[model samples]
Target: MQFFPIFLRSEGARIVVSGGGETALAKLRLLLKTRARIAVHAAEADPKILDWQAEGRLSWVARPVEAADLDGARLVYAATDDAAEDARVAGLARAAGVLFNIVDNREDSAFITPAMVDRDPVVVAIGTEGAAPVLARKIKAGLEAWLPAGLGARVRAANAFRPEAEALPQGRARRGFWAAVFDGALDGRAPEPLDRLLEAHKAARPAVGEVLFVGAGPGDPDDLTMRARRALDRADVVIHDRLVPAPILELARREAEIVEAGKTGFGPSTPQEEINRLIVGRAAEGLVVVRLKAGDPSVFGRLDEEIEACEAAGIAWSVVPGLTAASAAAASLGQSLTRRGRNSDLRVLTGHDVNGLADHDWATLARPGAVAAIYMGKRAARFLQGRLMMHGAEAATPVSVVENAGRPEERILAATLGTLATEIASTELTGPAVILLGLAPRAAARSLPLLQEAAR
Candidate 1:
């Protein structure tokens, strides 16, 4: 509340800047960004300023700022390091009824320049009210990285469709149409043809609802992809899974309907058919629906079944891949799933099949130095241990069980294969976990004594 921020209209307006060094040059750089008619009052100016004046970008007064220099100016900058001269310039500007800013002097100025991200017509300004310029620049740097370089071009392209979008009634219909276009186009999804979009809007046809299969990466909300976050923001209905954490779910629009279609091992689960029905049914209501799944939906997430259902229903669908549990678990254990000269191939296996605990090529899996990540393996830990051991796998093979990967409650149990089942049984894990075989926690060497005792 120290200072209120506002964007001044600079087009064709006169702006006077005082001083000649870097401070004046700095203000001139920002002023040049606008279409303002700049005039500099400097006894001796920088070569760049002289060049700019020669190029007709700004007029040079070639003298110190005086009362007459403040006349007819819309805005003025007293950028001289001299405090007395700056105060005089500020007084003259105030009397002339113009906006004034003193460079590096918040108390003496009417306004302060903010860290700005300019995407042509789209401008984002971050100011700390002259309290934290460094922090403001840091934020600007982050925004520069997050925003696409071609955003200005994309925004310009969208302008052409605003008229067409206006064909729809103002309010939800028009906003939804534009939202879809921006969200889709920004993410590289092709927009509908302009004519078709206009016609659809004109006719007031119910916008075809879309189903976004967003991967809520592992369990952390921060792990959610930008695209996934946009999907949640626009979603009218979010059909989420059990493994999808509450924090991620809370990201959805406040008015969005949240439905839990979570499936857990040996627990009451929402039937797959019911989940498909819910997605299709919600989308059919002309609502943007999100099928939020934990980890990569492609990895044992029954994604294909839902996608197939969506296709059958003639609903448009898209997928936003997320960080799967295996990757997060590996990160938690501080080990790579495939290490140089250690293991070249990595197998991601499921604990259960349609019938029961799934069986894999044990011989290959049991090979020394073989590495695999087992998903949904908590209930089948003993079965998996027995099979691997029976296939000539050594009992001393390293195994890491990562529960609640990427979550604050995450636990890493490092043990040899001989005691993986026993260690897993000893702990109560209510969160989805991944089991790493033939790969040990980074601390496995240090925990060897405890691991050996647990096996006994």
Candidate 2:
């Protein structure tokens, strides 16, 4: 919360770094990434500075900075350990109308250098506003994994087509053309400018925007429902999860702009407010956006909020119900949740904190003859199962956990309900998961052999 993030391009900016020690050298190294014109001033410097100067990478002044040094410079940094000199240099830099960072003296600074992660044209600046540098670095490290490797190239590719996009007629048709590009259709790998021109001519037909609420299933691509697969093929943009099957994403229109709408609890995320804004923004632009969710959009998918947002914005949205994580998990084990004549009820629980409706009876999930399929309940398995015992469910009831269900590399671990805690704790599940509880599972297990033989 301390930092306001930003990204700035320094292509034409003149940057002057005043100092020569390791700290100054580090700052200069980061500045080097900008491709900005650079000048360095220091009484003495590390060997790396001399090497850089010798290579003509940067201009070096042997003496301290002067008034003229700040002229026309966009930014100046004083990293000298001497507080007095740092202040004097900062004061002079400010007078010259340049943004300046004074080493370790944020109070006297006109500008504080933000922690940055650069991927040209896709730079991410982390500003704690001078508060949490460690948190900023941690955030940067996390983002490194999520950001694409060739983002700069992809962004440059997007930029290259702006003029053509702007020239296209206004309305859904023009935006749809760009939507195809975002979906990876217009990449240089595909065709040429002529093809785009041809497509534009064909696109004179009326274009209308549609919304598909797709269930991402679990973390396995094969777990995707038949309808989901077809939906993905028609997707213009996939609003997906961190846990959605990667292969599923790859199957979508390659130029599809993927918006990470997954609510990964690990860090701050696009609030529902902003996500709703983004969804309506792109949809209003006439793109077919797939509002992808991890499981069945009906089963605990925050459809209420999303639907309300769309209705408020007067955008057309539709739900394409998917196999919820519970169904996929149960199916992976060949377990029929609503097995005829036995499990009269099939229950699904959020398992996390819930408010409203006079406090949920968590113990009902443990009731016999009712299949209890827990979604995202791993964290509370011990407590959940224990509550089941208190409520009269057998301690040795059959329990199965399906991880990466329906994947080619899928793994199913079986244990008594009592031992699920140890199994889940020790199980090497690296993706989203589901928990199943039922007496019918034993019968389901018996059917797997026949099912396996049938597949052959």
Candidate 3:
């Protein structure tokens, strides 16, 4: 971000503003909310500014700003309306080594103000680096409506009760207490006192850590579920699969320990047993652990083995489902996995397993209008083609391979079952890909010349 948002302590600090017209009036209205000492320098002042000076809200000088006016100021605002005057005042503020902003002039300003939703200690600042002030104001208005008016009072009570809340252990215990307080467990209007709430929290048992099997979703960060996002935010350790994109992994907490437990088709992989042990060991240490897998964990993710390991170790576990690659690939192809008059059932198949090339109900898959999403099928393309054809599958059956589905680098290769193996080999398919059996890109999607060439 070009501009970082920060809340400077304004208490007992001096802020200088160089302007006298409508621009200066607009800024003074917001500045009056702060506890800072505001000083306005203008040769001729607006009536409202003069009234504010009379009301002792700020100090007004009847002259243009000088270099000495910026001395000892925490911040300076040049809202002189005229570009030349604002620029001149800005130069003075810069020479004085003070951060300054030129109202309505973001290009030359050292700092910019953000639209704010003021809830005292719970202030929310929305900034667009001066790119879209109207959008920023819209966001602020939404937040103002969403946040309760009494939120500041609630926060104040919680702040006062913090010392007592600290009696609970840090990490989970403390976080849980604060979460409960904000969730209306200690209502400010309720008869139960904050001290009583603190005592009750202190009496509660300590929380144990658990493992959440989160689906990272087909290499796209946007496809992540809210539950999965929350799991990553709270995770102390994240054990992720190799195919999980780096952008998704970046969502994890900065302090979170990331471990790569990746498995590749026809390539070296971390032992499943070792991965299970790692999950159990981290949870046993009272750390919130996340086993981040690409796509849906239940679908070809070897989820059962890891759950069994957690069960054997008496470690608690849960699953956060993610959008599977099959769905994303189908979406990218502008097709569906199942259609009413075409396919009544949808099958998710694996290309390879412990027994080498995975075998499936090839006869059923060979039926007319049959549809299936094949995972890890890139390396076993020839084996899959041979088996399906041997089981009476049509030679002209449409097949589409989506590489890195839902990702920016995604590619779609279309072919018929007759040329499935050849097409895959010729393409030198790399990256994680899924094969769509009995499906092709919709006509509209085929407008792309590459897909049209493949279809032809």
Question: Residue-pair clashes per candidate, as listed?
Answer: 1, 9, 0
Q: Score candidate 3 by TM-score against the native.
A: 0.90
User: Best-fitting candidate, measured by TM-score?
Assistant: 3
Task: Report the C-alpha lDDT of model 2 over 56-148, residue by residue, as the tens digit.
Answer: 788888889999888899889999878888888898887898888887777788767777777677777777777778998999987776665
RMSD of 3: 3.0
Worst 10 residues of 1 by lDDT: 445-454
Order by lDDT, highest first: 3, 1, 2
User: Which regions of candidate 3 fall more than 4 Å away from where they truly are?
Assistant: 185-192, 250-256, 426-429, 445-456
**1 or 2, greater by lDDT:** 1
Relative to the true structure, candidate 1 has a C-alpha RMSD (angstroms) of 8.3
Q: Give the C-alpha miss distance for residue 424 in model 2, angstroms.
A: 2.2
> What are the lDDT scores of the predictions, listed in order?
0.86, 0.72, 0.89
- TM-scores, each model vs. reference: 0.61, 0.51, 0.90
lDDT of 3 by residue, 136-231 (tens): 989999888888788888789889888878788877777767766777522434434667767788888666779999999998899999999989
Question: Which whole-number lDDT from 0 to 100 does residue 102 have in model 2?
Answer: 85
